[model samples]
Target chain A: MKNQTVLFRSPVPVAETATIAGPKEKEGPLHAYFHYTLEDDLLKQDSHEHAEIRLHVGVLKQLLNRAKLSPQEIDCAFAGDLLDEIIGSNFAMRELDIPFFGIYNACATFGESLILGSCMIEGGFAERVTCSVTSHFATAERQYRYPLELGCQRTPLSQWTVTGAGATLLDKNATSKIKITSGTIGKVVDYGIKDANDMGCVMAPAALSTLRTHLQDTGRTVDYYDKIFTGDLGYSGSLLLQKKASETGIILHNHEDCGNLIYNRIAQNVESGGSGACCCGLVFNGYIYDQLQKGRLKKVLLMPTGALLSKTSSLQGESIPAICHAVSVEVIE
Target chain B: MILNKEEQKVYKKEIKDVAPKTKHISTLLRAFFTGGTICCIGQGVNQVLGILLPSLTEEDRGGYTTLLMIFFTGILTAFGVYDHIGNFGGAGSIIPITGFANSIVSQAMEHKREGIIFGICSNMFAIAGPVIVMGITASVVVGIVYLFL
Candidate 1:
């Protein structure tokens, strides 16, 4: 795959992840809302779809409060879930008041939504939009490709779908000292992977495609940004990413971008360790956001990635093809 | 829980050693609960959008819905709102829609290798593709089984 390059390979741009810091205010009196019902009955069963939704609904409310954002100010909503009816999201949002848009890309749902969501703001169609996706151990296993109740063994390469959801609020004013500058959609790439455990082998190719697109579109190189992070490839996938990309005549900063090497469950018995759309979310929200707010880093690129596969195709013995959505955000202040 | 003979030795060897990777979590509770707190926003956005969009939308024309929603999401993501929660909270912030967006662009800028097709492009879908493939395929099979039932 290396032909001394095509002589015109593009440079990748760089920036720091945007920043936000939030936590409940301690000085306030006890929360005045009276009707809060702590429904304890749902704890009896496995991690169901509705249970996940309920958990996520409460999480978003506090997150928004921390951000000092109110529901009335948001103009639109983009969301997805492993459930067919998107029931987790649908029911979770029943109590709030904002415009809703539904989208699906399985693991890639976040990226798909980001492309559409950012375009809305850039196109001047809306002031701000909130996007989200959800999943759970039991719900995803049952809905996606297998049933967790079966207790089948997973490979060392397998990663969890990350039983949580991440939400981002995008706006046009360039407030928050960060802004969305661009979005790139990745094309589907196929690698024959049948076992659910071996995701690294399947997704590396597509991740390569979009990373290139971002650089080519802007005529920049890898050194420009503070960090480059991919979605949930885990350890094996990230290694393969380095190996495969090297084949095409390119070398990257060791352990610079791939998501696999970032967080390890060394703390939690994470098998093969690190999977899920939320993996990146947690890292960005936890680590990257603080760094940005502190002015520790500036100019970052965030790409939400996905492997596009359906049950019919896999059962039919089809190969797995993947795609990624690349959206660039910069911290300007 | 009891550790086996060899397992006990291994645990003793590494337990107190600080992580060579990064200095992140101060406590497990902070990581778990903090990530969790942010997810509530995604849920709220969903509920809020359902009402606001339904009123503005006709029967079958919610094309710009995702766009509208993401702009708000983008703001949260951009302001470091979501990212901060992600680091302290861990996976809770990552599994959601906003985290997905942050993953790709962050990686691309991180790598920025010479071959867009290889360095950046190939890695873009680095982790997520396989999960989706598995999830979608499984959902369809379940749908089939449900139909047969």
Candidate 2:
């Protein structure tokens, strides 16, 4: 391992991916790429939490079906969500027979799971692994901010929590050209931002920190990858990251944020952009994965950024600490 | 990663510079109109009550108007309309008695799945709790001052 980065000798192939987007996300530009789109976000469940769990289960099942593998064939699964204690992933795992590892790093959970799953495959610990994440707008709203029906106005900086789940299946034996090449673990970076609504500003520094570390460790320039995709740094946040990166002499010419790409901000009424754990999950598994498969994008760096702030911490006036994990995916001949 | 005070200050300033500024003038205008319309509706309700019951005291009409506003807000909240009003009106919709009803009603609806005691009842005041506390505290202080006077 070179500092925080791991270069896999035998790159694990991404065999299959499945995504289930919500009603609102279904209307987005990349709607056609998703494997399934929910007719109703509630899915007839009594609560949004249960609906999120169901979405998680649906995506996992879809991945298995696409890969033609049973739950028994999968050695282990890594998953997480934005919910307290990660109940979305936990309850979903209960319905599946695969061994599970429940993890959390806020919205960057998908990246953490990908890195860990790839490590398991590269280390000879597991032959086949599944990494998944989920998030629901209503559930996240009730937990992190105001109730769904509350007549409180959203701040201009506030992001809409994405309602969806995505899962990726990695196999050592799969002949897929798309493979996990390397990964860089992020350090928790806090620049003393207190406003939870301005998450893009909060998480942008962490994304920049991880991106810098990844470049330093790999000895690669910013142009090494076709694009560097950050998780949920809505519009303003991505601009902040770009400005800050350029200030440090690292120009982010090919940087795009999943939050920004997932929704039409003005038309969708998502003030900033789409956020939550599934923000990157859906975009990566659906849109980015499709691009890679079609050879439109050969090399890509996926850096999922997370803001580690709880309701109690924000209420207590503690600053938000953020983390970002970068996994380089490439198409190998 | 750690940054010194100076670096933190610089970064904070950069964040502020990058963030999109809120449209203050437009927001103020919207708030003014929305709040004024709501107050007008309250007055209209009071007048209707007065005409309906000629013998009722002024205090009774005032109390009933408040009740009517809360009831209307509760219905709008249940039907999921007030949140959109809030989205457009911003502070206009949020500074009225309707907003208070919305705070309590929304919480109750959100926590209904957790069961009555621990869910709806406990969380009902999640947002309104602070407002109620501050109101009572200020009122008590004023009452004591009046007693001395």
> What is the per-residue lDDT of model 1 for residues A64-180, given as tens digits with 9 covering 90 to 100?
665577888778878776676778778778877877887766666766666677767655687767766655554665555442312123445566655545566666553477555
lDDT of 2 by residue, A1-333 (tens): 999999989888999999999999999988999999988999999999999899999999999999999999999999999899999999999999999999999999999999999999999999999999999999999888989998777788999999999999999999999999999999999998889999999999999999999999999998989999999999999999999899899989999999999999999889999999999999999999999999999999999999999999999998899999999999998
User: Per-residue lDDT of B19-80 in model 1, one digit per residue for the tens?
Assistant: 12333455456656754664565556556777766665532333344454446545655454
Candidate 1's DockQ: 0.01
Candidate 2: list runs displaced more than 4 Å: none
Give stretches of model 1 more than 4 Å off: A1-47, A254-267, B1-149
Give the number of the best model, judged by DockQ.
Answer: 2
Q: Against the hidden reference, what TM-scores do the models get?
A: 0.58, 0.99
- Model 1 has a clash total of 123
Give the top-scoring candidate (lDDT).
2
